[model samples]
Target: MSDTPELPWPVPDERFRHWAGQFADMHHLVRDLVIPLGLPQAAESVLTTARELIRMSYFRYEFMMIGAGTSIIAIEAALADRYGKGNLAGYLKKAHADGHLTKEQYDLLDSFGRPIRNKYAHGDLTHVALTPPLAIGMLRTAITLLAELHATPSPGPSAGGN
Candidate 1:
């Protein structure tokens, strides 16, 4: 048997996109973003997957939930390579203490532990309807935060994808 657990929802087939090619296609600010030098490959992979899922959310907006939720987990995974252990919350303190993140950045992400991160993780019904703007913003926060935690200041936000 495959080790993968059964998904609660319908399995996505090759034709996952609906009304795709109808528009110019979704874009993400994080697309082609550079991860900090020496960042863990596994972490970078998760982060990419998270962003791609968010971009795909434009086709099926509900995918925003998966994207938003995965972004938090991506942050946590990035932390595992940088810090010792624990989830995003505990690691943020360590990241902050090390001058990896600014107070404002730390505070914003630490605050996400509840209404954003945890709720999505637990499959809260309200969170599934998470808006695209909110989900995209969360991902931006995650990518910037991860970059800071590693090294090299972020290039800073720019106008999002066309």
Candidate 2:
């Protein structure tokens, strides 16, 4: 038997699977749509566009991570009002401190996700070698973290009217 521990929440495999199919379908649809517009007549242009689309789709995990991080920062900023304008690391730290993320989740983002994202964003391609499994794991973690943070109840006014 395997010794892996059971996960506390469901991993988002179905959504990712569906998204993968949709991404591929999008390429096909784009190709079909452009055929009537005389794009396919320029074989080089069609191939280039298709290849670029596939390459972009392959990095969907990175895009999702960046998007999720941005969303977390936005939510935190909205809650903290004037105090939210800062770097992603600072925002993530604040989220952890505010009980939005657990210690493990925070560490995962701090250690792996954030660094990879930074490297990718800064055009440090040599350091951004992401495998399929790693990308999937990171995507799952990001989704889980975002979902948990969004589900948490916001603090409200005190009952004593202070």
Winning candidate number (lDDT): 1
Q: Candidate 1, residue 116: CA error in Å?
A: 3.0
TM-score each candidate: 0.61, 0.42
Question: What digit string (tens of lDDT, one per residue) describes model 1 on residues 1-162?
Answer: 999998675333223244244323454343544445565677677667877776665555566667777877777777666655577778778778877667866775676533567877777734444555566666776778776666654333344744
Local distance difference test, each candidate: 0.63, 0.47
The sequence of per-residue lDDT tens digits that candidate 2 reaches over residues 1-162 is 779987675333343454455455434422322212222133324333333433344335344444333333333333353233467677678778977667876776677667765665676634454443344344444444444544555444444666
Candidate 1: where are CA atoms >4 Å away? 1-22, 28-38, 125-129, 152-162
lDDT of candidate 1 at residue 156, scale 0 to 100: 30
